[model samples]
Target: MPRPPRGAILAVLAAAQFTVMLATSIVNVALPQIRAGVGLSDSATTWVVNAYGLAFGALLLAGGRAADLLGRRRVLLAGLGVFGSASAAAALAASPGVLIAVRAVQGAGAAAVAPAALALALGLHPPGPARSRALAVWGAVSGAGGAAGVVLGGVLTRAWGWPWIFHAVAIGSFAVLTATAACVPAAARTERARFDLIGTAVSALALTALVWGVASARRAGWTDPAVLAAFAAAAVLVVAFLRIERSAAVPLVPPRLFAAREVAVGNLLTALFGSVWIALFFFLPLYQQQVLGEDPLTTGLGQLPLAAANMLGASLAPALVRRVGSRTALLAALLTEATGMLWLSRIGAHGSFFTDVLGPSALVGLGLSVAFVQLTGLSVAAVTGPDAGLAGGLVNTTRQVGGAVGLAVLATVAGTVTSHAAGHQPPLEALTAGYRTAFALGAAILAGTAALAALLVRRTPADGPAHAPAPQPAASGRP
Candidate 1:
């Protein structure tokens, strides 16, 4: 049978990815409403967010392997069904416990969907300009979806109700699920490749512990016994996982996957990018709400420029890559990001959105688009066949881990600085000082990432012979 159209396949897959990306940010805007509706305490309110992060980060590796072994199309369908159902259930949840549980389930589904969608996209498109263009679209959608989530969440919650956010997500997810079932081609499956249960268990536990520890650090200090114990447990579990992978017949994560320079460097860059970018997205809104006295709707509207610029940057990435090569493109992107961070660091007690927010947001968004697109291409550059899913999963896993850590660290720093300055300065001045400190630190981190990317990820040839795409042994079957 002939393969499905690449464009159609990418559209469906990108939509699936868009849903996953949207989930990560949408609830953030609705958190205040959720807290009030569910009568949640301040501490309990945070779990509504972290529960999703914990499950998504912990299960990604296993989810990736499942996609390869169980067939990407099959796994994708399962994930969508789970996510859609969870979203619907979450919409009607009356209690905080119910909502948090459903959110965790939604994250679990996203963990499965993310790697499979990426692998399927890679499988459908051959390497070259076609693949480059496809990746650009993928990157743009993912980045824009993330930014749009905050805006959409605000609109839906304000115009309709907070539950409408979940309702909309459910509707969108199921629509994509139906379209994917009809459009995406199925991948060939191998019976010989089995899930590594031991590796999965240990690695999942390690990641869960690590993420849980980091997520709780802001509430419970880093030195708290619970935090220390969680980290210690994670370390031990990681050692065990490495040992198991070394001996297992079919390891969950093959060491050979990291042997590629592009894969290793891409993951490292993504981690650093996630650290700063996620924190920026989180805190910028806080500044808007607290200092500027803007409502959620205005906050979302303020981010529109960033989202638009991000899409523009993604669309321009392929051309940039061809002109400057991937390494140079990444370097330029990082420098842009650092510059944007420095600009945003100047935000003060008295500031206008155009004067203080727009230019910096655009710069940061454009930089994010370029870096993410190029890095994603690099991450899967030489990988082929079943390993494609794993490569995709590793990239996302590292980024999520970095985001978890960054959120904790950045929040603590901003809070500490604000609290310290409150004793000596006016409230607005103290808050601005805290935000400026975070932005400055973020700029420094991006600079460091640029240096590391330059040193580690080499440039692709400006002119090189075309290489054929890697072959997949699986059968291609359309619904």
Candidate 2:
């Protein structure tokens, strides 16, 4: 058969990425409708979101490794199948337990789909202007997907019904699956080593516990015994996973990969970036609804400016990277986002969206999207062949885990501030105070990350080689 057009392949990969990210946030607007429709208790309603995140975040490493051992194309097809089917099931679910279970399945499928899709995208274009542009598109889709989800969820839920949200995902998943099968070429798998079952299990458990603990801390207070136990268990399992990787002939996460400074620093910055990225979405809607007295649909519409800015930034990032070095571009992006966060901190209870939200949203959207592109490029710079999938998975894992932890911590901070302020102020003013404090802290975190990146990241020429060398297979392991 003749090869498919490059545009077709790129579209398929971008669609897959957008779909995965959309699933992460699309249901937020429909949560109330879903809860009432399915007779869910308050706790179960929260699980509708948590279950998906836990499964997705926990299985990412394993999924990425699977893509390496299995063919990336093959894994991508399998994940799409699972994701599509699970989406259909979720749409049909009539009970709370069934809905949550299907959501988890959807997340598991997404976990498999995300890394495979990203690795395939990297393989499609070599390191150059072509790859940079491809990554720019990738970054745009990723950053915009969450914001777009809010809009789509509101529209779909209000127009058709809550189930239409799942229906839309199901339809999109199958469409992407068909397109990928037709357009994406299958590559031969080179790694013939044994799969690291122990490492996969241990690492998955540790990530699950850690994400669950932090997520629980948001609702059940940080001091709750169950939350403490979850954190402790996660710590112990992490230590065990590290020890296992050292001794295992074939480790799930090759410790040597971290020897690449780009991978290390890229992931570290991604974590900090992820924290702010997720928190921004979480708090912005609250400010609009609780303080500005906007409805869900209106709040969703309010995010359009941010989404547009994100796309604009993504489009501009490749040019910026070409003009200046990635290090400099990244620093600039981070500072821009920090400035936006600081601006957002000035939001007031009486503020209007135009005066208060629009300018900062534009700044944040621009900065966040550009920073994501740079970080992604850096993270995978030194990876090639078999490790490409692993690098893809590692970067994504850091982002998701960081977002979860960041949101939890920020929520705690906001809650504390709100409680203390409530004693002396009106309800709306107290809530605004909490939101402002969280945004200020978020700005501080971004500034701190930029400072660290400036100190640690090595400068390289535009379109130049990676700072670190590609990882070699461990001497003890056979390939």
Candidate 3:
């Protein structure tokens, strides 16, 4: 077959990426409707989101490695099949158990799709101005997907019902899959290294346990025995995974990857970035609905400003990086986001969206989009060859795990504060107080992230003399 145009390949990959991120946030606005449709208890409704996250986070590393060994195009196709099929099933699900189960299956497929799609994207252009431009598009689409999910979810649920949200994803997935199959070229596997089965199992279990424990703590209380047990199991499994990696001739994750300052510091910041990024979407809608008394569709439409600002930031990132350098640009972006969070901390119980939400949301969206693009570029700056998939997987894993941990911690803090303030304030006032505290704390975290990046991320591929040389690509496979 003739090779597809680079633009066509990018379009397919971007569609796949957008679909993955959309699934993550689309359910947020529709949770109430979902509960009504499936007869889910409050706790079970939360699982409708958590199950997908848990599976996606746990299986990412394995999926990335699979893409490297089996072939990027192959894994991408297979993932699309699974993800699309599961999404269709989720749309038709009537029982809570079936819905939750299919959501996990959807996540499992996402794990495979995310890294492979990213690796292929990176391979389309060499590391330089071209790659930076490509990454800008990636970041814009990714950031837009999360914000758009809310908009689409509200409109779809209000107009057609919650099932249509899943139906939309299913339809998009199949369309992207078809385009990918027709356009993306298949590459032969290059490396013949032994698969690290033990490492894969241990790492997946450890991640799943850690995320589950943190997620449960919001409802179960941090001191609960089951949560404690889950944490303990996670710790042990992590240790075992480390030991297995050290000894395995073909490690799932080579220990040396962390030695590169770019990978280490970049991932650290990505974690912080992810933590706030996810929580912002999670809480903002609640504030609109619970405190401001907006309906779901109205709340979703209100997010349009933030989505616009996010895309604007993404479009500007490459030029900013070129002008100011990655480190300086990153610090500026982080501080911008922190300032937004601080502004958000002043939200009032009786506030209007224009007075309380718009400005801060725009600031947060702009900062988050630029930061995501920079961090993604930084994380994979020194990676090449088959390990591109691994790098993609690792960066994504950190983001997801960080989001889980951050949401859990922030939720706990807010709940405790709300409970304490309920005696002195009206219910709406009490809720606002909780949200204020969480936003303030989130700002502090972003401030800390900026300080850390200032100290640690000394150079990037875009930084001329200080940049490390990327390894040459292998002879047979896609880089």
Give the clash total for candidate 2: 0
lDDT of 3 by residue, 1-479 (tens): 78988988998898999999999999999999999999999899999999999999999999888877778888899999999999999999999999999999999999999999998988886677677778888888898899899999999999999999999999999999999989998765465678889999999999999999999999999999999999999999999998999999989998766767789878888998888888998999999999999888998898899989999998988888877777787889999999999999999999999999999999998998888888898888887666888888898999999999999999999999999999999999999999999999999999999999889887544443112345444443753
As for model 2, its CA RMSD to the true structure in angstroms is 2.8
Best by lDDT: 3
lDDT of 2 by residue, 264-372 (tens): 9899989999999988988988898789987678888888999999999999988887778778889999999999999999999999999889999999999999899
Per-residue lDDT of candidate 1, residues 235-335 (tens digit): 99999998999999989998878766667877888888899978887888888888988878888788889999899998998888777677788889999
- My TM-score estimates for the predictions, one after another, are 0.96, 0.95, 0.97
Q: lDDT score of model 1?
A: 0.85
In model 2, what is the error at residue 369, expressed in angstroms?
0.7
Q: After superposition, how far is residue 299 of candidate 2 from its true place, in Å?
A: 1.6
TM-score-sorted candidate list, best first: 3, 1, 2
TM accuracy, model 2: 0.95
Name the candidate, 1 or 3, with the larger TM-score value.
3
Model 2 misplaced stretches (Cα beyond 4 Å): 189-191, 462-479
Ten consecutive residues with minimal summed lDDT in candidate 2?
A: 470-479
> How would the candidate models be sorted by lDDT, starting from the highest?
3, 2, 1
lDDT (C-alpha, whole model) for all candidates:
0.85, 0.88, 0.89
